[model samples]
Target: METNSKETLQADFDVFDISEEFGFLLEEPLTHLPDHYQVWLDLANNLIHLIESRKLRDLVDKMPVLSPDLLSDHRELRLAHLALGFISMGYVWQEGQHAPAEILPKALALPFWLVSRRLGLPPILTYADSVLANWKLKDPTGDMRIGNMDLIFSFPGGDTCRGFFIVSLLVEMAASPGIMGALEVMRAIKVSDLTGIKNGLIKVTQSLKKMKEKFKFMHNHVEPAAFHGKLRIFVSGWRDNPMLPRGVMYEGVSDEPILLSGGSAAQSSAIQCFDALLCIQHEEETGAFLTRMRDYMPPAHRQLIETLSVCPPLRDFILSCSNSDLCQAYNSCVSALVDLRNYHLNTVTKYVIIPGNHAQSVGCPFRGVGTALNTTGTGGSNLMVFLKSVRNTTQKALILERLS
Candidate 1:
């Protein structure tokens, strides 16, 4: 018997108020807030310049604290968050990782906190802000290829910074179809449609393969050396960091300092969406860390993951049905996801672990948001261990096909 109606499952997805066309991405993010918030727009637009001149702090310190209520729409509020996030990161680390600012000035902190709270995000740079909502179509009518896309704001690291953020955006873009496929699989499961389930899973595997191809382009644009020392620090958050033992004080928002995880690919909702729909189970520790990363995502995206988690168990269905075709389809989806994670693991080793190890060997060790590599992720997990656990758990989801 079918356990749920298609309409009921869809109602859950609709309640989150996400766009049908763009999935979790803020479609056509506002390039500028309204004129009253011009001060913020100005700061964000010229952020790289201000940081380069060591003038970002002076200007942010003197700027007026704006009310987030002034922003009228979802897109405006998101841009406000992204703008403030970029500015805050630049402000804190302006003097380099060794001398991060102990307090975020009220001009940036108060508004950032209010905006972040309203949006159900932490007041720091996150994958949602930097990658999902941080892009624009250069030609407006063109495809979202790297050459046709551009970043709305950035820190230092020049072309490398541009490459890193844009490629991450492209990865999200590549995952859109997989998101749709997951939705279709859920709908199919509600109706107990075997053909629908198998076809949907095939779509998912194909989408993941495309995502992997797009992810590999990171090497073409961002060099590992530049990413480790120069660009990585800007997106790092306050929690579990060695440098700021007490965390960051947001001048007017709270009397006590606040702790938050830095930006990480782990925060991206795309992969989590897959994990939930496929019913891939993780061990307790790995599962908890993933759940924590969800807090760093936009509220709607987080809710989507939660909703899918409680859906009818797809893995159990494949096992009980004893259908060879369905089992193979399900296994292929898991394998593609595993392949993507494997590539990501390799990329992290090259970009963070290898570079960080060499720096330590030369008598210099990194501190702050991340340490000498293996100890932490930008999201604060024990880097390689957490990733390996996740990949292995995903591999375990494959069911043995029973021959008819």
Candidate 2:
């Protein structure tokens, strides 16, 4: 990474601190941050406070009815997306284990649903519950994706959102032991003892294969309403649009106008973190492709990924090696990663290609498709760069070992 990029990534850390915002909730955990991560944090904070302090009916009265004209530089409608998502998340998560599931008051629920319908956002895709926006951890010892993603859950169709994140969490967590084992194997690597290294690679490959299956299960079971729809007005400009609301400018600000908008790709920063753990690197010269995709993730998470990219375990595996068994193990690992990448490509196909929902109303990223082999975010799942990098690195090892 370049020095400037290093500095940029360091800024991508997690932001939710319990006592700072909503420590007063009677019980239960404060699982996410307030939405509207725009230019003004106050805008986001104030809107959430309003939702918490006011009666549901009063709040509803103030909100404008859903309409296309309402989207013209409308801060109220934008903040409402955040306000409702935050309130509903809080309402749902406030009670802890015994909390009522699906029990939001009609005042907040009805309008939120109506607005979400207008925006092409599912209730699950809101800032609070979105895999893109709300996923973060209180602490990560190392490798953010290895142990923490405390927030990023995908809801099942009809069931309550309770078990939603856990399924994805399980898939990610299944790789933890394999990663540590691979690390252990890397540390013990020698010309003679290929046994531990090969075993470790096999385990990692198996786990990824299982992860692929899980993704398929997730894709198959996903309710059409969840990923299938037109994108909301706020996100209509997502990655393709150069325009920002009405007057939001690009020059004076540190981030692009889209970064500040509710529809920006930064909302899905966690997915970028996932790509990093799997060793995905994008093309630098490509404009707004994977080259700068990491910019969409939080600066803090980007830092963590950068730190891990150079860590001894994963870094050492790719540096140089001449052991035939080690090379074989790495080749198998590459195959497994390719399998997962193929699965991601298929995921894009299901959402974008097969179903053919890539239109604007289909909502920001879900509408676009990117391949999983080389580039990213073109049309489907954004796992391609990572997949390609891992394969290239391992293939290099195979060549070096054969040459020796």
> Which runs of model 2 end up more than 4 angstroms from their true locations?
1-129, 132-170, 182-200, 224-226, 230-239, 242-281, 285-304, 312-320, 357-404
TM-score of 1: 0.93
Question: What is residue 317's positional error in candidate 2, in angstroms?
Answer: 6.0
TM per prediction: 0.93, 0.46
| Candidate 1 C-alpha lDDT tens digits along 1-404 | 34565565457557655554566677898898778899998998998899878899999989997888888778888999999999988888887667889899998999999999888999998899998899998899898778998899987778889999998877887787788788788878888899989988998899899989989899999987677777887887788777666889999989999888889988989899999988989999989888999999988788878877998999988888888898899999999999998999998898889888776676654442234333678787888998899999999887754645
lDDT of 2 at 278: 39
Point to the candidate with the largest TM-score: 1
lDDT values of the candidates?
Answer: 0.84, 0.39
Question: Which has the greatest lDDT?
Answer: 1
State the RMSD for candidate 1: 2.9
Question: Where's the lowest-lDDT run of ten residues in candidate 2?
Answer: 17-26
Which runs of model 1 end up more than 4 angstroms from their true locations?
Answer: 1-21, 363-374, 401-403
